[model samples]
Target: MAGHSKWANIQHRKGRQDEKRQRVWTRVSREIMVAARTGGGDPGANPRLRLAIEKAKAANMPLTNVNHAIAKATGTLEGMSYEEVRYEGYGIGGAAIIVDCMTDNKVRTVAEVRHAFLKHGGNMGTEGSVAFQFKHCGQLIFAPGTSEDRVMEVALEAGAEDVITDDDGAIEVLTAFADFESVKKALEAAGLTAEVANVTMRADNSIELTGDDAERMQKLLDVLEDLDDTQDLFHNAAL
Candidate 1:
């Protein structure tokens, strides 16, 4: 997971201002809509919606937009009916890759995803082909200057499984999926905010790549991420 950590660190250094904030807002809004539609619009009564709203607020997404999404999800207004899809594949250096998406058209989404892999020296694979190489876990990342010991104390008390310090001084708390919300709330109540908090697939093992292979891997991942339908991209490449 070194590569994943490295990539995450790089993204943090770049900061949210470096990316197109509007694009990020759109993605977060879509997430909110989907979570609300599936779990109901009331965050107080819906854990999934609550988490989605938390993420949206963290991104500084407009409250009006967030409320409108919930309304649409609750059928107070019309909205796109998105379906969740997962695609597994192998990238350069035999790195395992997984792409999560929310789309209204599976056929189009699959075709575009497969083309992305093939065009980038990767190949899409059958379901479970590379999925078994990963595990879904709750990940929470804290900014620098946050006390690791203090964060760990609260996280562990809240049922976090592990707290790791990355090379960039960022703290990452891993927890069982069931304990994610509890742990996050604990941290928030203590005035510790996570830069990134989500349930994500972590690779069980990683492959190392350098030189041209590493560059190619980065480009491929970027292309995959740029896809509007793509939600999250996970890979086993050790950066």
Candidate 2:
């Protein structure tokens, strides 16, 4: 399994958003704006935009705010333009870490990201250094007690790459990034809901951190996540 979903990294990142309060909305808005500007304002025609909108909906974001974000992105209203940037690095115990950000100021974003790494017992790597350790895919996890047969039937029939049920009975559906939206719609239409759904860079392997290493790794991840430009983060550490 390469420990892809064992730690449920994306879900953990979302869970921790509660600590930052409004930062989740800010990150979601940035994603929405970027997706809109790049793919146009129509969610129907824009997969990325549609995915962003879905996340917004799941977060209970206001419709007015979603519309405002789209408008600003499409230039119907004024707003700062943002560009996506990624940083890869080695964290405590040499765990692979990837930080995703959207920023209008590349210099500031770079500095903030670099500073966090250096200050937290880590160092940034050149582009692609740690990226090869991950796969860019869509993941959907269902609750432990969800009907495994139902999930497998719908997800597999709808173009899922694989359906895996963990030892504890949780179901995970994997799909190619491009097929994510369609597969998700199919599952939901069949009355199946995922507990965690997103397109993410899942780790290929894991580094089990314990004691001092685990504590340090958590601190480093927290620092990187707290940066204003950070949109999404991934790591191989099982803390």
Candidate 3:
């Protein structure tokens, strides 16, 4: 919460080329499968599944595909079972990176991830290496020109943990994972929608990188993101 909004990363991901956006469907489908598998197939009873569904919708995934993934995860159909794996690493200038993936083959995922790191001026670390630098929570970010007072009133009244307005005028609403759904519902009801909304491992501090260091870090991140099994990536770098 002390550093700037993680919106920078979100924006960078959102700005991926049109060709790269095609891969988003695959990633969100895996997310849907894992969420359903972990918390039943009923979105009404499972907040994670509900969020995954929302992501699927945002990605423009077909409803048929969504239902099929849920069915497969719930055992109505045969499919490769997936397990979540997290990789911690340091990018150029010692920037912390956390990569989350869902894969049936852990060995392949790890090798691909490690190769990306080593080949792009990074070092993969053991579990718990840089995780201590982050907090797993819900984040909702509004644009710089949005109405801050209105957002603060609605968010705080709906159980938000904190509302931060950055020096650059961006509004950030922080919530516990448990309160995320409720807060998001309230904001939407009030006709206030966020530019970025998700449950994420938000960095507690940021590493400012520029010039060669920043360029190398971005290249490393792009490689990891393009991997077929990679689900999500987080970093503390403010490039």
Candidate 4:
């Protein structure tokens, strides 16, 4: 795993509220629907659904809304079907970027995604262009000054793969996708709350950006994140 820049994480969290709440709920509901459709509505039997529900809870989505989404996926209610899509690109400072989305209208989604890239000093790439620079894993990151020893002990005992502290003193616990929920529970039970937790494509390396490049990159990310269809976005830039 590559060391993540705290500034990037801070900006992401700080800017999340700028996105419309309805859009966030839509994206998370799509995730739940897909997970339930693929596995089952029972969270105990479906890891993906469990994770989706966890995210819904974190976002403070209404329980009624969550139940309705699951019901739709389980065929108890009507719902708009969606498909997942990924876009790769290079942003300012030559940083690799990946945009993940879910949409019922592929044509509209692609057109908007491409336009956002081009409008923000970025260029879209072929499917595999920048994905090679990332790793698919479950990541739980703690803020700086967290107790490294405690995080490591609880995480490793709960089947985490690694506990790394970056140059900025942030502690990151990496786990296999299968072990993510278990490890997360253990860490929380140990009172080591995470600042960010998700199953994501983590960059394997990073490019440092400064001055105009950094400002442009941040703007590009903000634009992409605000897209209604975008579920998640990742990049290998240290702002």
**Model 1 pairs whose backbones collide:** 3-239
Q: What's the lDDT of the predicted structure labeled candidate 3?
A: 0.89
Each model's backbone clash number: 1, 0, 0, 0
TM-score of 2: 0.93
Relative to the true structure, candidate 3 reaches a TM of 0.95
Worst 10 residues of 1 by lDDT: 1-10
What ranking emerges by lDDT with the best candidate at the front?
3, 2, 4, 1
For model 4, the run of ten residues with the poorest summed lDDT: 1-10
In the range 1-239, model 2's lDDT, one tens digit per residue, is 21233535545666888666578888889999999999999999999998899888888889888999999999999999999999999999899999999999999999999999999999999999999999999999887789989999999999999898765567889999999988999999999999888999978788989899988999999999999999988999987
Q: Of models 1 and 2, which has the larger lDDT?
A: 2
lDDT of each: 0.84, 0.89, 0.89, 0.88
Clashing pairs in 2: none
Models sorted by TM-score, best on top: 3, 4, 2, 1
The Cα RMSD in angstroms, rounded to one decimal, for candidate 3 relative to the true structure is: 1.6
RMSD of each: 2.4, 1.9, 1.6, 1.8
Q: Model 2 scores what on Cα lDDT?
A: 0.89
Query: In model 4, what are the clashing residue pairs, if there are any?
Result: none
Q: Taking the tens digit of each residue's C-alpha lDDT, what string does model 1 give over 136-168? A: 999888876799889999999999998888766
Residues 122-153 of candidate 3: C-alpha lDDT, one tens digit per residue: 99999999999999999998988899889999
